[model samples]
Target: MNQLLWMAVGAGAVLSIEGLYWLYWRYVGSGSVRDYINEDQEPEGDYRILRKIKTPNQRIALVEYRGQMWIYGNGDVMFSTTEDENMYAEAMVHIPMAAAGKRNKVLIIGGGGGVTTREALRYSEVEEITAVDVDDVMLEFGKHLEAMVRFNRGSLNHPKVRTVIEDGRTFIENTPMKWDVIVIDVPEPTGRYPRLSRLFSVEFYRLLKERLEPEGAINIACSTSFWMPEYFWSIQETLKKAGFQVLPFHHFVPEDGEDWAFCLATTSPVDTDGLRMLVSTEYLTPERLKDMFYMPFYFANGQNQGDIQTDDNTVLLDIVSEADYEQDGNRKEYN
Candidate 1:
């Protein structure tokens, strides 16, 4: 009788926990969870979960939301969406690619989804492209998973592309090989991300400069310019302190309905005034590309408000601890 009572208590606890989860799921938006749980929930309206993967480094999910498929990292980090990925990808990849005159041997750091690689492959001059990510599983998904394969268009498996599973900063530090263009398509260091925050430091960019060819350039995805103005400027300032000529620009992602900014950094002299695309683009033309440099009125004014980000003094990490991004009454939710 006692044993039966204990079993009943355990079962009750389980049921109660599940009930709470159900309530949270019902109330909140699609989760950005750290736990390895594939939420294969039933299709609610236009939202459905397609896949979930657990890597030693990160939790990944592929969900179909609002007639578009989206990939989320750690439940919150929306890596890419089928909706306007091309617009963001083109803006991220093309500027730096155009800056690099040789356009051969490009290195894409942290874009395991392969969207950036897909854009880089557009240039016929690209002889060898290396795509590196910390999560090997995500790269496998991009290379093999049917939905990801379709989305990335098998760019990971191209003969000209080589996939490496490694930390982006470590790879840059160790490799003797120099690249014509290096695309930093990693997540923004907005939260308490120790590892990721390190990547934004002056130290990392200086090391990256060493790996870049004299005529080469790099493009880093500096989170939303409007939402986190200070952080955005900090990244640009950080790059400048690292001894690179920084050209800050932004483009809108329709799915998120927010302005995502990017920076083109190079030690080489860049003629930002006469920038043009060497390859044809689906979304970004040369005219639009040049115009991206025009900053929002308020955002332009705060360009000098940033402190240089460093490994020891992580201003970028400290500025984004949930409370800072609380605009109006809406809580900060990157997903």
Candidate 2:
């Protein structure tokens, strides 16, 4: 009996050691999913990785799924690589046309995959588009990624578009050049990562106001209002605190499966009547844009409890934390 007990203890010790090593090998030792797969050979199924970069901010990946490419950051799909007529990319394109009647110089923050800059280039009045992002590898890889370059209609390679590899906050704070249109095509503040929380803070919004021309306008991604109203309200409050007249709007994105919200803000009131959708787009029209201003009853009155995000305090991060979303049934199980 004593010898049997000794053998059992030894087995348990070996199993424990193996488990710990397995954990380390699975996460720390192996870099990313891309590291395990061969570049020349196609991945198991229809999905194929075009490019993958592990940035300090997040793990960025360009994945091809079912013949379509997707830009994913930190396990969340930011947008589709293919140019879908009914996607958010189309709606965001019309923002410059709707807000800034004359687009001369535009600044795009977090315009990954180069779609936003592509959309902005459609305006004949637009002269230059500067896109800034933190991940240098992703930006460099985007230049060569066939799916991304083609989807943007070669806008990434256009002479008018200038790409900058730097943190969005630092770039905006240091830049002296003011912009006619500033588009914040950033990721949603889901609090899965802390680095993204600062972008939605009141301090950042204030910085954005400083960078805009007197006649300039800004576009912000407020996330989906379908199941998360607090997230939308928090952004509105922060933007208002930064001293801008905010116009909140929502549109149902087919790829997102939720009513995503965006805010058009300027120092002065935006005359929607005078605004015209000069660029032909599949998603946004004059009639559809009119309905975006009216918020649904449930979405407008949801229980939004959280602190206002500031430079010192990232309250928005706590509001949309992945743990909280998991508990609240807001996040899908597979996602």
lDDT (Cα, tens digit) per residue for candidate 1, span 137-215: 7787779877778878899999999999998988888889999999998776644345788789999999999999988
Model 1 deviation from the true structure expressed as Cα RMSD, one decimal place:
6.3
- For every model shown, what is its TM-score relative to the native structure? 0.83, 0.80
**Residue 29's lDDT in candidate 1:** 40
Superposition error at 290 for model 2 (Å): 1.5
lDDT of 2 by residue, 1-335 (tens): 99999999999999999998887774467744534232322334767666677777776777777888766776666656654523677666576556764589999888767787788888888889998888876676557777777777777688999999888989988888888898887866554467777788888999988888877888888766354566777787788788988777777656636687888888888877667677887767778777767666634624543346787876667656643546545554211
Please estimate how well model 1 matches the true structure, expressed as its whole-model Cα lDDT: 0.77
In order, candidate lDDTs are 0.77, 0.73
* Candidate 2, residue 288: lDDT: 76
After superposition, candidate 2 runs with Cα above 4 Å error: 1-46, 83-86, 190-192, 254-256, 301-307, 322-324, 327-335
